[model samples]
Target: MTARWKDLCLDADDPAALGAFWAAVIGLEVDPDASPSTPGPVSLVGPTDGHRVWVNPTTTPRRVKHRLHLDVDAGSVAEVEALGARVVLPAEESGFGWTVMADPEGGEFCVFVRDEPPAYRLHGVVVDCRDPFAQAAWWGRVLGVEPVHHADEGYATLEGAGPDDRLTLDFVPVPEAKVTPNRVHWDLVGDRDELVLLGATHRWDTPGWTVLADPEGNEFCVFAA
Candidate 1:
């Protein structure tokens, strides 16, 4: 059986602060039921179960550019900056429709301005890889979704994967190889053995979940069904 998208997880130095930043920017709320007595992830909830986001605590500092990042739709770039996001590449200078930005902790994300904010601000998840088509295809197989390839743009997208079909998984070509562990990753519910046969290599495991790297070396966690 193929894996199903579970939720998004982010490594942060301060889970509480980062969780608050994302909750405010994305119109989500900090999960009130999240355990406060233990050093655990800070959970953020949206209108749907598929819209959950976890800000997990980590001690390792980010050393390289993020291979995976989030894309958001906002009223304006200034709106996001007001929430502690810093602009890295302005849309006008990049000749792109979106502006590149960094979170308060320096993780990169893209912002697309809209006249009116949509019901959901989290637009998509993007991965930088050497071969966009292959990377997208591999994830499509694992996640049981079809990838729509954009040959002219050198990118591929997997739609219908998250809340209200508003979230997309995008793969775009990049020159650089992944050298450090990704600060952002997604989780899935599936069988570990089946995934291993699908070309995923086991990375490590904990009592709760096992970490596996995809064909392109992006790390993701798998929880048994």
Candidate 2:
């Protein structure tokens, strides 16, 4: 009924370097042509049904707070803490229990222990960037989803049909790039037509995905089958 974690967001002085670093870490194939439209570069990692990383461009130095962050399940909290991430504040038990964490970059995202998955799996993944339209254009070529809704360029969503019904992709904008490597990303699957209409633009003759920038210049993936 709604969207879930779509893609990873990474803030870096050099988007290309960070993207390359992740490509190696995740065993994701590097498609050079998939760079973002902004002066900065972008890259796609992994298969459609696995996970994807987005490298956001930023010149601002790491600061006091993060606009958004992720709470990942790496088996245990201690497991991720050992990787150099810190707790901004101690994890708390809420009406609904959840864990709060600050990534290596000091951003905040929450993790929840759930008993059930969404009724319908993610139809498609999305990445918020500087120019949602431009990013949509890039991904439209990657996935075959058509633009179904637009919000004053603030957001753009793509739609595709599956065994059940059509899927959607929504790209939103934020003020700045994330200061840490993204622990949560998307795994795009399905056919290229399903991908292209979603707003992925073709850069090369790759089998899947096209690199693109968001309305605010953030990077995201457009996985094609």
> Backbone clashes in each candidate structure, one number apiece?
0, 37
What is the Cα root-mean-square deviation between model 2 and the actual structure?
Answer: 10.2
Q: Give the local distance difference test score of model 2.
A: 0.48
Residue 67 of model 1 has an lDDT of 95
By lDDT, the best candidate is 1
Q: Which candidate gets the maximum TM-score versus the true structure?
A: 1
Report model 2's TM-score to 2 decimal places.
0.38
Candidate 1's error at 90, in angstroms?
A: 0.6
Per-candidate local distance difference test: 0.90, 0.48
Q: On residues 64-142, what C-alpha lDDT tens digit does candidate 1 reach at each position? A: 9899999999999998999999999999999999999999999999999999988679989999999999988888998
List runs of model 1 lying over 4 Å from the truth: 35-39
Query: What is the C-alpha lDDT profile of model 2 across 88-145, one tens digit per residue?
Result: 4444544434466555455454444334423322233345466667656655554455
Every model's Cα RMSD, please? 1.3, 10.2
